[model samples]
Target chain A: MFKVGITSLCLSVLLVTSINASTSGKLLLSGGVNQVEGSAGGGLTPWAFIGGYGTEDEIGANAFITNVKSSDYNMVSTGFVVGFYNRFEFSFAHQSFDTRDVGATLGLGQGYELKQNVFGAKVRLFGDGILEQGNLFPQISFGLQYKKHEQGRVVKSYGAKDDSGIDFYLNATKVILSESLLMNLTLRATKANQIGIMGFGGDRKNNYELMPEFSIGYLFTRKFIAGFEYRFKPNNLGVATEDDWLDVFGTYAFNKNFALTIAYAYLGNIVLKDKQSSLYTSLQVGF
Target chain B: MFKKYTVCLLLLISCASTDKLSTYHDFGEKKGIEKVVDDLFVYLLKDERTKESFQRLNLDKTKEGLSNFICVTLEGPCKYEGQSMKRAHKGQEITERQFYGMVENMQKAMNKNNIPQRAQNKLLGKLAAMHKDIIGN
Candidate 1:
């Protein structure tokens, strides 16, 4: 109950902050993890993910919808974003996870679904594209993400009942290569309860996990890019776990206005209990 | 490897010959003016201080007005109806340091874009003539 109250208070604060930040500008869509930085589809361009738009002088906004599908389950997520003074961004995302077979195994029912909402904000403390000192390094950004999990069922059988918690993450990202051939790196730490469908159940201790993400891409021509990213995450869900997953992805742009991305991910098993892996797809449009 | 080298060598020779056109005839052609102005634009876009200052200006509109400005200033067939360079830039608080910075940027841009050094120097000579009218120093 105390944890739930704390989560609600934090969410309220995030909402107020987002409302105050709306005057700055809407959030802009970012390229995905395939680009080695943040988002998979539109994240590599300046101010693509960490909010804002480009640098400290422009304002940008973005919206996105993504779907992840596996053999037994599926998840759909949508988000709103805004950037201010080109240095800060505030965002909100709601993710719904559908468990297709929980009813048959547990006698609860079939087609059980759960939802997790994540509220996040990021600030670019330093770096600028206008100050192009070298091609080896470009910009750096810091960000925080807060997530809440809501269970869809009340039978208290499939997993934790009324599972809701918060995870805080700090991330740093940089572009190691530029223009024609680009590369990016990101390191993040989180304290969330559950990673995906399985709620954080073991010991209930705040664990700091290291997530290192990398992406390398080539601009086949001027308006198109083909790239991939490998992201490492901890598989521990309070029980037993295995290795992380590798997201292999690609993207294509139709000009400055529209783009599409497709990715195949291999989610390693956790505790030798269940095997989880899936394919993800996203579409993005911008002005 | 030898064939590639021979091909590169021949390409260099042909390029050098094409660039040897007489200065008098070249100066009057569209290519010459374009070459000079593009070089100048490149330099102006490079300097951090100049770039910051220039971003505040209506460069897209200013660029559109450049043809007329150049035609009249360089004794071409057209007469420039736009404001003089000094008058247009007046009170913008631009200093000699900033002007030179812009010129340096142009130099770098020219080199990066592979514009020949001779063409760059010729364009610089024209810009040098305008310094007195622009900087008032």
Candidate 2:
């Protein structure tokens, strides 16, 4: 509890500092949809979709909502992000995982659910679009995330606890074909914490795992863009092991002030043992 | 496959190394305003500010237009359909010093390109006619 309080305080301070550092100029707003397949990292089953909006340039702010579905469970998540000087960004997300009819079969009655919260911060050490030429490398950013989980007693009986841990990652992005094509490659590492709803286990030693991701996009015109992303993660949960996923997406800019994105993901099941797949979609809007 | 990929890669690499415009275009035609403008560009490259401005321009298209404009202005066999100097440069706040610096650079570029002084003077005379519109009092 005290740890959570301290984390919240740190996030507040960081946000305040970033806001003050922002120089008044022009502001840009953007939004997009993201989908995830398979049980990437945590054990929340193999399905989910995320939608979000962001304001950027000197200062930044973003908000998102996510939903995941499985044979016996379902989860919904909401997240927020803010940044300053385009150098540092902070984010917060909360998730609710529900154990449907399976809860009754397990003698816990129906409508049981688990909840998890995540807080993250990212800082850019080098790279800028305005400062660098086309021949130079793109921007790189380093980030950290802390997650905590909680659940109802019936769900807790399955050995769930309020677990907390940290994760770190590095991301690189570039606009290779300026006005036509854009590409991004991200490499991330995180301590194996429980999947969002499942608490981090007390027995396993916290280990760093690499999560590499790639995205390629083409802008058909100033108003439309299509892209895809692939991500890899480790199986941290004992319930079901998961594999990587591929996401295909498209975005349309309504005008200078509004845009929308949609995506479909093919999840590759969990535990490498069972082959389960799912689809995900998201909608985003921004100034 | 490796050989094919290597050949493609070399093609792209060579394309990257090639200049955006040919030297002949930079030097302008053998006799006319194209020659004069080429001279001016060479001269302008010497001054830091004018050079910076020139570098900022989209070199390929701008150079083409300049070549034609100079030829037409020098009584050569060409018509310049682009915007006049004054109308084109309005709101840019270009100063007399900057203009003169540009002219001197043009002279130098002509000399470097082997254009004779007589031809340089002939082109300069026509360039002078647009000063009123370009400088705007």
lDDT of 1 by residue, A26-90 (tens): 11123222121222223322232444233234465444555677666676666555666656767
The stretch of ten residues in a row with the least summed lDDT in candidate 1 chain B is B19-28
lDDT of 2 by residue, B48-80 (tens): 647866877876677778877766554455667
User: In order, what are the TM-scores of chain A for the candidates?
Assistant: 0.70, 0.68
By summed lDDT, which 10 consecutive residues of candidate 1 chain A come out lowest? A27-36
Each prediction's DockQ against the real complex: 0.06, 0.03
Question: lDDT by residue for model 1 over B18-116, one digit each (tens)?
Answer: 633333233444444555556666556664556766666676566546655654444455556788777877767655446555655555655555554
TM-score of each: 0.55, 0.53
Writing each residue's lDDT as its tens digit, candidate 2 over A41-61 gives 111211110112221224434
